[model samples]
Target: MIQSIKITLFDERTLSVRFGDIIIMPSAKVLKNAQYIELGSYQYWPVLVPRGIRLYTYEQVPGFLRENPYITDGYRAYLTSRLCIKSLFILSNETVNIWSHLLGFFLFFTLGVYDLLAVLTRLGASREDYVIYSISLFCFQVCMLCSVGYHLFCCHRSEKTSRRWMALDYAGISIGIIGCYVPGVFYAFYCNNNAAEICSSPKQMAVFVDPLRHSCSPPYDIHTFVWFGYCLQYWRQVYLVTVLAMMLAVFFAQIHPHYLTKKWQKLRSVIFCAVAGYGLIPTFHWIWLSGGFSSDIVQVS
Candidate 1:
């Protein structure tokens, strides 16, 4: 009697897992709703378990991980990982979220490098040492970088940890979104004190771009004022305002409530969906602003 794994579709996109013995597959609307069907001697089966999402035949999946499906062992790992990731971000727990954000921090670091090198070529930076000023952009990038990392790693934390990490994660998102527009705002409006500021600068600076693949400079005719510290100071203000706004929205809604059991799962889903949809506004703004409705530059994603 050789033992083998049994996997059956439980819904349109889920699986009920059994080691052996029983065969039960019902068309249930609620996937992962915890309905187990056992048959045969029901004792013939070595051990029965529920898999999730993708049903992987033991032979198909990697041997080391084949034992763990979306449910069962895999589910626990997923839960732990998921919880930790969310938690770390809220509390600012400083593991995966922080670590992941750190990765983004480095990316902007490189972008600054490019900006600095480019400045060196063009007669060694104007007043305010625009080359070093690239650090401001880097700073904003850092915020986004941290936010992203938090999102990934916060899943590993305990409940308390998850709450704090999620808050921090929200803060990080606020920071990132605000940061995204800082460089443009600073460079665009630094000079013309008389007129309401605009972010045409990012587009303007883009003109300087040559080795386009590597160039990080903004395009169009951007001109920062000599008094503005090359626009670094302005972005700091942006960060403060953005963080505040993000905190209010995230907390006020009680988005990450206590006890994320099956009950609140759907609520979480809705919140996430809403947040994601809201995020598209800026994204769409960026593409629209960048392309300016230029059919050539824009493509539907």
Candidate 2:
């Protein structure tokens, strides 16, 4: 006799599976989760696993032997690559990390649009100020979105692919650090020094910009300063601080594995706070040196 199976939908992304002598209710959790079955009896059926399914040891991770020595054997890992982007919405240990940044991207995006429109619609808003604000905002959004992708897709089938996502995550960190510098540097340069004279310098160059720039009439033109002139800005000091901060972050990420042991797990949160705090050092230093903070620049930066 040929054995048969039947499936019933519990919801849009969940269902119940009935085999010859067993009935299994697969939860929505199976979205990012993996499952299994008896080798010979159900060789043709899909294995529907629940999210946070089975915890995997470093050795159990194919190609992970001889690596991540610091990691202990008490963590969950997906064993298969059957699900692609669908896995992103599923709950897992990485669920918080992924959703936090994804939501943050939306927050920054909304703020960027609102602020940009506010500046352009105003009668006396400075065009340079708007450009600086937008650059900073765009950089922040890219970084956040990249983080979302990294955390969500880092569990792909190929270990090599997972490593690539890690690289992208680092790139996002670098770009975010650079973005944090743009406005802070621009404002400190023009606000504390000679704006009119610097505007006329040969360093200012015109470039293609968003349609939003047309509202200001000339589009966007950024002043690419000379090495000496650029170095003079207080934000460069901030950039240096940021570089150090990023280096520290990368060091922690590489040397200390977050998945290693429960005792060192808190390092993840510490690293995040430390990088953010380090980025603030230059801002505070500038405020002290400049005698007071420029509300406009500080607000955006």
Candidate 3:
């Protein structure tokens, strides 16, 4: 015998389904406002699956969520925090964007554990190396988690919640930039004197002033070495302090009401790009100090 089914909703609370010769009914309390769809049948009983979640098109969503016109469909809208978390399992346009960053968080977190337990241990890494690696990886993980949270919760019913997440996402980007700068600057100028030791040793200073020594007297050579070492250390501090200040400025700027609006989109991009591009200043300086592109350090790096 051929099997067929029909569904009827008598009111907001009553639902009935007729499958072949069998009739099924759900109580008002159980069926009130719940959403579901029938999926063929098993033996004589019809299978029902919950589908309370809804997906919207780009134009149908709110203005803030309409950032991408190219993504024409598959948007979750008007959801509460509970529903937002529930939607993580639902397949939608943001599925990849959300999962990718989530996975990245896990990847970085795993790498951090391995670095501390195995990689750094094998390398006989110092306390400074441990601190740097921890900071860089922690920033990466924070960046990933912030991006995931922003994307996952951007469709929240409250605009304020969405904007807050957006601000956090941008701040995470700045932190990630710091993560890159810390290690790059640290290792790039690893041989140079730190703030505590402006003049490491006469032997190291001699290496720095060796070429100039033949061109000058002993006293002049010593003076030049001290001056050059102090200058290098000074610039290092300046670069780090500048980056920290820029990060703080960006964080404070994000507090502005108009910062996250579409009107300031380009300005936002420009700010981030400028912050990232600032790294080039130290990069070129390092190249110059390493004897231009011909030096072994510059060439290998």
Candidate 4:
């Protein structure tokens, strides 16, 4: 039997009612034309859904939002913060840019959780491995989120808001680069004698454990562990420090007033390219250290 019924109206002809255990909603036609629709309810508040959100042409947007002349239509501009967020659901030119990175954030976040729970645990990952994986995946998530923020809010009425998000996007890129370097450097010099020497000082016969050694035994008589006597530890530190310095330099450079301006566009590309290209230096050095291209380590890597 139906007890008491309660009804809430979102707009004309669009109402939701609850009768005991049953819920009733408005028809799809009414919902389509609803003036104020409730997306969902949070703990204490209903989520606001935008109504009659309008799209504009490239020329209709403000100068700051006119970065892409090729994209002539379907631009959302002159929107308040609330409206900017609502625009996430709307179909617009920036929708791809926004959703792609948003999805990327979730993907990396899922991978991080999986690695920590299953993959890392199965491999008997050390404290350092856990830390490295966490940092790398976290950086990736940050990068994705920053990109999503910039794309979503770039349509804000205030140019200042958009520019701040852009700066954050750049910072996120730098962080992601650092994440890549951490794991790559750690594993590349995993068995380096100099690194082992530095880590376990006064212990000449230290048994340096390589995580990869647990899986497949190498062709060396030293069991799964391979001995290396090169100064790779020095080069490893040098590469990391160099990358950090370069990232900092790039970060500070973006602080300049004209850094984001179209006038310095090519210069910005060159700067980022240089920073990324610097990795090739240590890569080639590693190949050389491992006895060039034909070596077993080089081939395996």
Candidate with best lDDT: 3
Q: In candidate 4, what are the lDDT values of residues 55-159, reduced to their tens digit? A: 666666799888878877777777889988888987778899999999989999888898899999999988878976886788788789889999999888889
Model 4: lDDT of residue 125: 83
lDDT to native, each model: 0.44, 0.56, 0.73, 0.70
Model 1 is weakest, by summed lDDT over 10 consecutive residues, at 39-48
How many clashes does each candidate structure show, in the order listed?
Answer: 43, 2, 0, 0
Q: Once superposed on the true structure, which residue ranges of model 4 sit more than 4 Å away at CA?
A: 1-49, 192-227, 252-258, 262-267
| Candidate 3 CA-lDDT value | 0.73
Tens digits of lDDT, candidate 2, 163-185: 65665686577567767777665
Worst 10-residue lDDT window for candidate 4 reads 37-46
lDDT of each residue in 146-247, candidate 3, tens digit only: 899999999999999999888888878877887788777766655444523534566654555555544433234555555655666676777767766776
For model 1, state the Cα shift of residue 147 in Å: 3.0
Tell me which of candidates 2 and 3 scores higher on TM-score.
3
Residue lDDT tens for model 1, 27-113: 564444432322222222122223322222323333333333432221111235544333333322234445665666777777777
lDDT of 2 at 198: 48
When sorted by lDDT, best at the front, the candidate numbers are: 3, 4, 2, 1
At residue 180, candidate 2 shows an lDDT of 76
Question: What is the clash tally of candidate 1?
Answer: 43
